[model samples]
Target: MTSLSDLRRALAPQPGEAGTAGGSDRPPLVVALPEGRAASPRDLRGWETKAALAVGTSGSTGDPKVVLLSAAALVASAELTHARLGGPGTWLLALPTGHIAGVQVLVRSVVAGTEPGVMDLSTGFRASGFATAARAVLTRPGPHYTALVPTQLARLVATDGPGLAAIREFDAVLIGGAATPPSLLARARAAGVRVVTTYGMSETAGGCVYDGVPLDGVRLRLNDGRIEIAGPVLALGYQGGEPFGEWFRTGDLGRLTDGRLEVIGRADDVIISGGENVSPTEVERVLAAQPGVHEVCVVGVPDPEWGQAVAAAVVPTDPDTPPAEDDLAAAVRAAVGRCAAPKQVAYLPELPLKGPGKVDRAAVARTFG
Candidate 1:
């Protein structure tokens, strides 16, 4: 099987003009990893044709699917990103290369004509280990950059030392993969970190928006409050002709104001409880603000009375002394309203994670809701 290390060779120019591959109908090249669930790569003949990568999503929301990306799509995404984050010079591969975010790092490095630096992530992400890797790359020539999830960014922001400093040194540090709380972003900036909150998914090759602004050649629109995206970075479609039109309709719900988008939450994540629409994300945001509430997820549970009752699965700061149910409920009610407040609260040691860092809402409902 071919490895991701052969990306440059796969894209090596033949007799074609710039921006297009030499010959059309060339078989798709799969970038295989030495290990992982997709470690044993099989030939999907003629799948990509002009594409060189096949990255599987973590499928935090539902069933995971493999997204097909073309060389033009990945190249466009990388160029757009570099334009926004200062021309790419050096990048640290702090994420899993099997995923789009990490794969884009290597692709961006290839386009920048530089080598992408990597850190060992198999042992679990750690601030100390991240610090060492960042230090090694900081000494390299030219500007530096890295991409990370909110959880990793939170760890670096909470701790002090080389990890925090190394993070601050980067020309840009992209935070995505899940919704980032405002408090976390504020804290990172307060600590002198250049945190750029990105919004996109494997379908878009990686992140196509920088801090609520869409990248050039990218467009965002709302269809009955659902987010729809159209851009050059759009993936060809899911495997087996998933049937994508011009615009990709995202499952997210959002609203636009003054030409900027404000993503509320997932469209399906809305809960109808007692005749009122309850946004679990809104409830979780308020509850997370309460003291002792570390991480929180709100879901709807079957209830004879309300049809679907509000339920909260919380990860408390101190498992020994979990936050009082009454206090947590009061906080949600205070910030949102009584209708949105969770009727039942389950305090767990930690929240269940899917893929990278997204909370597994379905698992949370099955276990606690």
Candidate 2:
């Protein structure tokens, strides 16, 4: 009858317990058995291994996989982050702890020897709720911090009161969970919110790249345009116990320019429309920046003439003044090319969210398919 709290401690490797891949003389660390329900961690059985945590991945795709994280990996991630973002500090837990992003908040707290101020996600996210939770976080010593999805940050910026003010005071606020629109980033920075866009997932122990720059000891490469990351912070492996090799190849498509990684979109998400490869993110970025658009998700749907057609699901800022389909399509055409223009547009109240507030591309595609 091990409670989740006790399991967390048993899984947390003690000092000096973490060593290089196969050279650690210490007995294997926690196996991190996963239970979606209450009271996890049963018999060690054949699961005993060198992993400290088990996390699940999130993407636009419906498929999600469990990733195994090592103590060294998590420690390296937190240490490198502290060095980059002005050292460890108090953190407000605004995300669900079941995900890697949420798990890292607690992990960073442990590394900093502080307790995190938890946000009541059971009641859904609200500016008032975040503001109240953030106030308590700032009361602690050291630089106050918090991580959130773009939706939460956008809401804070829109609210423009205690929530935005509280955000302005933090040393650094991490925004991840999905691709953040540049407009949103501009808006956040304009309000004096130190929003840092993070890239990585459960496979990388949360985010290994901060603001498009790889953290210390982390490396990035593009294989045939797909992102492959290698670093101390990389996850050990998946469940069933197959350890990763030198690098973990991600589904993300991106390029490196002057050592900075620029994530484009998912490689698998490329749309072949009328024999041209259309990047959904490129279209979405263009359409989202339009005046009336609040948020947008672009997906390729089945088309008779072109085999596949580019489509966009938009959330208009003003429901009464929804963006015109032609304007959005023209914008995309002007930016990327005609091949990237959306052939179909669906205006919605909000884009569908997958786990942890990421845009659910599959669902969006199904709606417009």
Residue-wise C-alpha lDDT for candidate 2, range 65-184, written one tens digit per residue = 667677778778887888899988988889887678888887788777778888887778998899899888898888988999999998899867888988999999999889999999
True-vs-predicted CA distance for residue 46, candidate 2, Å = 7.4
- Each candidate's lDDT (Cα)? 0.80, 0.80
lDDT of 2 at 344: 92
For all the candidates, what are their Cα RMSDs to the real structure?
A: 2.6, 3.2
Instruction: Pull out the clashing pairs in model 1.
Output: none
Against the hidden true structure, what lDDT does model 2 obtain?
0.80
Instruction: For model 1, give the 10-residue run with minimal summed lDDT.
Output: 32-41
Candidate 1: count of backbone clashes, pairs at least 3 residues apart or interchain? 0
